[model samples]
Target: MLIGEVARRSGVSTRMLRHYDALGLVRPTGRTVGGYREYSAEDVRRIFHVESLRSLGLSLKQIGRALEDPAFTPSALVGDLIRWTEDRLERERELLERLRAVDASAPSGWHDVLRIVELMQGLDSASAARRQQAVLARPEGVAVPAELLVRAVLAESDPNVAGALRWALVRSGGDVVAALAAGVRSEDAGVRRRAVRAIAAMSEAPGATAVLADVLGDPDPTVRGHAALTLGRRGVTGAVPALVGMVVEGAHDVDAAEVLGTLSRDHGCADRVLTALAGELAAPNADSATRIRLTQALVELPGTTAREALRRLAHDEDRAVALVASAFVTVLDERCREDRV
Candidate 1:
């Protein structure tokens, strides 16, 4: 076959075949009377081989070695190609995400596009200060997309930058609850924790409460504790058990106690909160410190049941617990007398 026929059959262009010949990567096995390059069957096969390697991201130089160097080992080269392809794919994915963010922003012009890109780069910056500035410095009237903020919030490890990202998400005013819900379900514990924290601040967002409720069963105690505390403050009685558990375990027990107190103010929920607290206190394994924390939590409750519970705790076996409970009982009595006045 001549060069043109070889190009036609092999799908390698004539110019590329000639270039390959020049580089000695593949040379036609013979020539015609007119001195045009002619390819034998084996030469055409070699052309196909070069094309195959090129498709795998091999440079022409590397292809030359692969085809001609008998001593060349393909294991290392193949491994390098895999890594290079993976890196390129990752870069492409990041670029695609940026483009999607820009598209989602509905940029009015090149200026808007550039500003969104700048903000995204800032959010991804190595310097935490730069990342925060990226979120905080977004220019007036240029809205950063909530999705961008969501990605930043989930990936951010820096506490200050993460806060700024959450603030930006709230200010973006885009419906970010769905994206954040997905973050809450992430296998990464850190991402789930950040997602819950961000959602806790956006409790007013539609479905935010439901998402927090769903997270109450999260395996991470910190995540479930945050969700429970947030829900408890929202007056969702379902959080009572988790909140009581926090008091028992001493995980943010102070905040848990305060929220439990607030939740107990609801006439219907009052007994449930009191009962859960009393149950923990009555548990045989309840340590003195645990009993004392539960006793202090009882003072937040308003009705006689809390006071009665405290009165019982005031005479408890543990001297320290009895002292704390006795003090809280007096405080509750003073509060009751004031309420009557």
Candidate 2:
């Protein structure tokens, strides 16, 4: 195909194609007798590939590297492209939706006036939900609610969520996090829900882990469970206290199961989880059936600490638990026979 045909088929601009040719990013495989650039089907494929990468925000230099090798696995770096596209698309959709809603609601004589004002903002959390209610109610000036606006930013996987947070609220960075932490305790169900989601998305720090622990007290069970999971990922040793309380004292039953499991598997809170396990075995709290299930869980854990905790439980106060551990001790004995325990 000639340049025009290639441009038509590939939707690549003529100027860009020429530039690509010059940079060897996409080269014509053969030349015509008249000396015009002639591209093969293979060239078209390369063009689409380049365009796709560019659409994903890759620089020309980066696209060139991608073309040269198919095995390129820049895991964390490549993830940035997907995150950027997702965030941009979400923003675009939100703005469009707000525009459409405003258009439908504007009075005949006041279309221009409403356009200068926002139509109505997007709802993210209950705080924002309240603002939306106020908007529909008419004549109440509404910026997004503090809780709802912050929740939206924190739920995002993209770092651009940071900008949304900064733009909506003028609070200092410290205050923003503190408010978000405090949001978990909000009486508004939606605010608590979104706040749990937001904090879960930012679980790289121990301070953030404490916030999740605090949310465990939320009346909403789901919020408590989400907090447990977020705390688990950070391996925050500080959460051990909360985990112990949740699992043993029934401080938050829904959170208890998942958080206790996460403490052992993900957070590496060895001592606390083991102590909780031993306490459950030594003194009975979970029913016979549930305790049996927990016995199976402890058996499969394959960690030496869990094994030692089991050994201690083998001499448990409860004869039933001791019996269950004795049966498991038989398995440990066989492993010892193989020298593999």
Candidate 3:
């Protein structure tokens, strides 16, 4: 076949075929009387081979090495190609994700597109400070999509950046509750913890409460504990068990106690709160340290029930427990007397 016919059949352009011939990658087997280049069957097949390798992202020089080098091993070259293809695929996927985030933002113009792109890039920057600035310095008109914020929040390991991202999500405030709900279900313990923490930071009324309520049963104690603490502060009585459990486990037990105290102020749950604390204190396996922590937790609860529980605990068999409870009772009595006077 001639160069034109070869180009037509093999989809390799004539110019490229000539270039290949110049490079000795594929040379014509013969020439006609007019001195035009003519390719034999083997030459045409070699052309096809070059085109095939090019399709696999082989550079012309690499293709020359692959086709002409007598000792070139394909295994190393193929491995390199695989790695390069994988890298390209990863880059494409990331680009597609960025485009989708930009689309989700619903940018109105080029400026909006650029702004969103810059913000997304900043969020993905290597510096935690840059990521934080991306969140904190976001301009008023360009809204970072809540999905992006959710992703950042879930992956952010830095406490300051995570807090800023949560703040941004709260201000962005469109269907973020749903986005965060997915985070609460993540199998990664860190992601679930961040999700629940972000969800807790959101207002209780805008479906965050319901999602958090569902997350109360999350297998991760950190996730469940944060959710419960938030819910308790929001006056959701459903968090009582988890809150009481935190007191028992000494996991953020102080804050849990404070929130429980606030919940008990509702008057209806005061007895229940006091009872849960007293029960934890009275459990058979309750060690002296557990008793001491529970004794401390009691100071948060109000009403006569809590006072009476503290009074009984004040005389407990454990000397340390008695000392702590008695001291709390003394403080309570002084506060009561001051209130009356």
Tens digits of lDDT, candidate 1, 135-162 = 8888888977788889889999999999
User: How many residue pairs collide in each prediction?
Assistant: 0, 0, 0
lDDT, candidates in the order shown: 0.89, 0.63, 0.88
Error of 1 at 206 (Å): 0.6
Which sections of candidate 1 miss by over 4 Å?
A: 334-341
Q: What ranking emerges by TM-score with the best candidate at the front?
A: 1, 3, 2
Better of 1 and 3 by lDDT: 1
Q: Which residue segments of model 2 deviate by more than 4 Å?
A: 1-148, 151-176, 205-207, 216-221, 244-269, 300-305, 308-341
* Predicted structure 3: lDDT: 0.88
lDDT of 1 at 326: 89
Better of 1 and 2 by lDDT: 1
> Which has the higher TM-score value, candidate number 1 or candidate number 3?
1
Residue lDDT tens for model 2, 111-179: 444532442332333354444443344333333334434644545333344444544444312335566
Q: Which of 1 and 2 is ahead in TM-score?
A: 1
| Pairs that clash in candidate 1 | none
What's the TM-score of every candidate structure? 0.94, 0.40, 0.83
Question: What tens digits encode model 3's per-residue C-alpha lDDT throughout 1-341?
Answer: 78899889888898988898898899999998888889999998888888899988999899999887889998999999999999999999989988889999898889999999889889999999999998999888777778888889999999999999988888886788887888788889999999888888885547888888898887778888998989888789999999988888889989998999999997368888887887888899999988898899888887777888889988999999999999999999999999999
